[model samples]
Target: MADTLLTAELDETHTAPTFAELGVREEIVRALGEIGIERTFAIQELTLPLALAGEDLIGQARTGMGKTFGFGVPLLHRIATADTGTTPLDGTPRALIIVPTRELCIQVTQDLDNASKYLKNHQGQLRVLSIYGGRPYESQIAALRSGVDVVVGTPGRLMDLADQGHLILGKVGVLVLDEADEMLDLGFLPDIERILGMVPTQRQTMLFSATMPGPIITLARTFLSRPTHIRAEEPHDSAIHDRTEQFVYRAHALDKSELVARILQADTRGATMIFTRTKRTAQKVADDLAERGFSVGAVHGDLGQIAREKALTKFRKGGIDVLVATDVAARGIDIDDVTHVINYQCPEDEKTYVHRIGRTGRAGRAGVAITLIDWDELNRWAGIDKALGLGIAEPVETYSRSPHLYAELGIPEGVTGTVRKAKVERDEDAVVVERPARAPRKRNRRRTRAGEALDQTEINSTDGGAVATSSDSAAPVDNAGTDDADENGDKPARRRRRRRKPAGEGDAAADNSAAVNGAADDNAEVRVTADNGGHDAETADQPARRRRRRRKPAGENGAENGNGVAAEAAATTTAATASV
Candidate 1:
């Protein structure tokens, strides 16, 4: 029952003493007063009467505008005031509230719990428990086993607990869809439908969301039976609050931390929240702020639930003046006096921009919202501006330490880093490799060993000289140029040389060397010497008698010579015949 600085007074134009005056039981009024909530927001004023009378209700209001109580109060009131004689035979819940976020579950549950204080013995007999991921199941299971009159949870968790036999909804008399638009945006409509099917057909359903977008409207058409529609538009759609002034600044990424420090030096109203796109950015921003000696906390998905909750609690309790968070953490954060919301980086879309600014200027409380847009984010802002109908396509150029920005936000002028000192040694020692070090220079070191010599081969094998006529077949009619042309063109590129076959047992060199030393006869020596790369005089000098012997008895005497030479000769002759 702590006093809520965040809650706004009831909208007097609609009605005074609304919920209680609208034929709601005195018990419900006393329950709300126990929680120090004596007034109703516009959403609640419009929807309470119909919903309390068991009529279906649809409430439309932007986020952070007290839609939780719009449906939560009536639903809980119905559960508490229901007849005890009609106990649900199946042990199913009498009321169900489905929200998009786990944080919203806690939020809606708090409101429901506050409303349940007047029922019976005040043991919180409403059996209210929040079911969501990132927590163990045993507590929720035990709560359901013991019996809960109402369940507030996300779609997935609700369906999961229901299917596991931990939660029964057949007797559910009231179903509330909080943030129905968000559920559709997250593609959870099918899951919501399945949960709806589990509830009794004869039920009073309430759908409350910031928008009655097409999907949500269609959902109401199918699920709700003649529900009355209510919409509460924000007082100022695109303008800064009366207490809030807008400061658009363009700053270099490197100078942003310094600028934030300067802003902190100015008079800060209450707790401040900075929004960053990424978890790492959130942590970095928080660290930067904390190093400046500011009490800061960071909440994002990367942190464990306990740490996130602790940070949120510290922020709520005023232990921390600044909170850095990712977009996900900022959702369903129902803090009212979050004096300011700073967008460290421009959000990706208009919807995100709306939600981020919605954190402040909540529940009729005036608050400030500032956005720091880099040069590259200009195009992104263009799209967002068009979507939100903001004609200012360009943001004023700003530096982290702009005097105008300081004046606008009521920050002190000419104040440098007062809270956190910049780490001089750390910045000097920081190793920031802009790009990967140029891959090690690979030197092509050429070396020739003493024994391993390089081949002194000519690039072009042909001499460009006239073809020469030799004793055999006109010296093979040199066709080197023709070979080069076939492979490439007329370009004088180096042609790959054909390697000489190694000397084998049947090589001509072996025969020539053997014959020269008188190991073979004159005919074999003359025939071997008549091959390539040797003196023509040696072939001619062979006796005419050797020539006649070389031609005589080509088959018979060659075979008789033995030594496998005749076998080699026969194989060569057969190859030549096959070619022919």
Candidate 2:
């Protein structure tokens, strides 16, 4: 049965129905006409009536099949047409939309806001607010305190506001869980359950997803009341599948960037999207492409909310030619002008592959999807091939410089990895858009030896004294002159050793008396002070002596100093013998 459903053909000869024909209100019909949207897609045609009739429903469709309006149109209509007697006008929300990501929250909020241009609830004109993380809480709180008819937000932020008493869900008449499968994948089921418990049980609930997995079915059974399951089946030769030309090739991992750079230079390529499996890979690919002279942007989880929004704005306005993103961040990105999509790495499953490629060939436009498979990811690609029934079970082996790649992809002859020089110059000289700068960080001051020296200079200058300019002046030494005697009643010698003169001549007189006391074992106190006589002169001369020693050449002065110390000890022995 599933196989039959998957292979079913859609009749192209049948005319598409308009929004007004589906019982949509005149105000919404006018809004749609203003945006030049007159015809309804298959999903909208099937689910709009059921949803507007206040029936619990599940609408299943592909990712880019106009599901937003299928549910959005009815969601707005129900709030506008609700009875005023029961519905409260006391600044409380009437409808709630819960999604899994901040990007999807913003997308859905914008779509709903555009659709509700001329819409009104029982209170007054309809107002919508998008509440998500990375935005300040005060603004959301103020918007709720004022009036809001609809609220679209992620589960975590919604619950946070609800717990803080800033959000009230009791009066919510319509609840929607968009992208239910993604929410389940992100582990938001517990928060979803708690949110469901907060809202009134008698309200109408709607669930929509690209694929109805077992968990989604169970979730629907638990929350939705006897819901009607509707699947918008596309023809096996659907426009999206037919218009896109897909090529799968086994590529070397190290050479993938070079291949992507060449593909971006294809004659038919316009704005392109490169999908990777991880955030790190996405950023790396974007950087590599930028170096190749293509204006590129990156959308990933690591970027701040402001940065992500800025990149998306640039891509939408044609400021950047390429966007690299992860699967999670690329959800709900509906850009119709994207002419090419490249899979930098193999997707994990069939659903992911479909969604990644769906970013292009949208709105009936032709596109190209290229998948590069590594040696390790062959098994993963094979599963996708089998599930999609694509005839290529084994992809063709291709290299970065292969001749067939250029011919098949319509690349100009003689083009290499780098973009043309003229194009590079033009892009380099283009005007750059600047974003607001972040605040400057405060740095801590650390103390070092050099800093201590400077501090000493400042202190001496303040005290009206000559400032010591080198670190050796601060070297610590024993203050033996302040003590009169040692433990044995003999004073410690404080004579300064001279490197230029012989040590025997400089200190023989002081050593003679000291030797006499030592040999006689007498209790007399002998004070061997420096030739400079006092502490003040000794302290002043210490730095000069150290400077002289450091200035001496290492060749002869080093040996001379060693020999002088031995000669001084011998002279002291000779003096002791003379005293005996």
Candidate 3:
């Protein structure tokens, strides 16, 4: 039966056949009708019958073709038709759909959920859950514990849950692997094999891929049991190639951003996608375009799952006009209205190039795919061109300011890289805002000490400066000027100054002579001489001026001064000298 079905010629009629004619369950047909999908694609028409009959099959189709529903509709129908009444609703999943990416997983889950809406009325209520990384495991665990009829997820997270006993695959009635080629590219064949080993041997399995590589064939032989191969050959006049205009240009890396900015301003431009080989390049290009006044968003691996989803949602809703992304975003995104795809850098291979350009020229809409190849990447681009049979071996030389670029892309004359600000009122609730540049502030100059011309110079002894010495007479002047004086109006309070020296000295005679001479030279006597005018009077008495000496230590060889005044003056001079 499988060989006969594989050999059967697929119908390639102009009018598509209805889902009911293909033996899809009534409930699924009604659900698909509700979503406005009345007719089935070639892939769907070929695979639906084999899948609905519980036959193992392989589906081959391109990126934009209706591959999801080809397997999705059958998988949902099988679960709904099963008699799960006797089985406990212990959260064991009955069907599994493993995809390559989180985005694709969510996409497939949504599609399956929509198709299974009417399952409650036909067969008991069927629960569908999407489990992937970047989401909390508790919710998925809780959903599994309650009950789930179908589960769509990535390989790593599915294996993790299965290993932890949260996901029970023993009862899985049907298993589907979507994008098997992508999984192989991502090195998930081992994981896929492990997961296949966990499921019951007597179960229906379906595999779908855009391209059938050798590894995928080996994988199918190992797991699938006499699977029927179904290939949906695109029509000769496929709308994808007919609607999309392709251009290859050898551009300088330094001017690629400017060229892209101008191309974005083309009259025919709509929602555009820019692809780069690296996440950093994608983010840089997005930021550069945003700074140039284009409303742009970036999607890449560096962003969190929520942020990436938010950007994609905004792009779909027309909030952002341009989306810059890496090749990771090339596989799962399915936006229909994208009018332009700009390859900011050359893609690594032909398959990647096809996927990147496929973002545009979708759904029979006319689109443009522009590839900017750098000087060093010419060989890589040539390889892709030869592999895909693109006849253009030598791309045209172009620059950001080239006249041919403006003419070919339909850019207005004199248009530069910058976008002019719109005169219309801005949306107050807009999520992205263009802030005005801040003004520079003035700074004050510091004043120098020379400009102020201060009178006093701070003398520091540690820096080896001379210490100024003043006579003892200066003390009398300070006392006379003191604000706090004794009540008797005589003298203010004074502190005596004492000078001490170390015990060792040389030449005692010379020291004694120097001390006496220093004392007599500095001292001044106060005399008392008075006379009466007329009548005789006793001579006025004057207090005698006496000098007191300080006693010296027993081991000292220095001279002692007889006059206390001379000694204080000599000690002051000596102390000043020692300090200097």
User: Which candidate has the highest TM-score of all?
Assistant: 2
Tens digits of per-residue lDDT, candidate 2, 1-580, equal 1121212134688687899998899999999898878898777888887788887888787777788898889988887877322365456888899988888888888888888999865567789899999989999999999889889999999999999999999899889999998899889999999999999988888898987889888888899888888777753433235678999989999999989988999999999999999999999999888888889999998999999989888998999989999986557788888999999999998888888898888766888999999999999999998888877778888988999899999988887888743533457768999999988985533224554543433333222222224533432334422222244422222234332333355354444444433333222123232333222333463421111112233444333344344434534544554443
From the highest lDDT down, the ranking of the candidates is: 2, 3, 1
Work out the TM-score per prediction.
0.67, 0.73, 0.71
lDDT, residue 233, model 1: 47
Q: Could you give the candidate ranking by TM-score, starting with the highest?
A: 2, 3, 1
Task: Give the worst 10-residue stretch by lDDT in candidate 1.
Answer: 1-10
Candidate 1: which stretches are off by over 4 Å? 1-15, 83-92, 121-124, 234-244, 418-580
Model 2 misplacement above 4 A: 1-9, 83-88, 121-125, 234-240, 420-580
Question: Which segments of model 3 are wrong by more than 4 Å?
Answer: 1-13, 83-91, 121-125, 234-240, 421-580
Residue 184's C-alpha lDDT in candidate 3? 92
Model 1, span 1-580: residue lDDT tens: 1111122233446554556777666877888777667777766767776677887777776667678877877777676767222353233567888888776677678777777766652243556778887788898898788767778899998888889987887778888898787788788999999999998888888887765578787888898887777665443454223345455577788888888777766686577889999999999999887777888999888898778878988988888878999887656788888888889999988777777877888877787777888888888988987887666687887776666777777777666775544465657667886976788886533234564533211222222212222223333223332123222222332333333334463444443443333323322423322222222322233211222234335555555344444545545543432332
Residue 567, model 2: Cα distance from true site in angstroms: 30
- The local lDDT score (0 to 100) that residue 83 gets in candidate 2 is 32
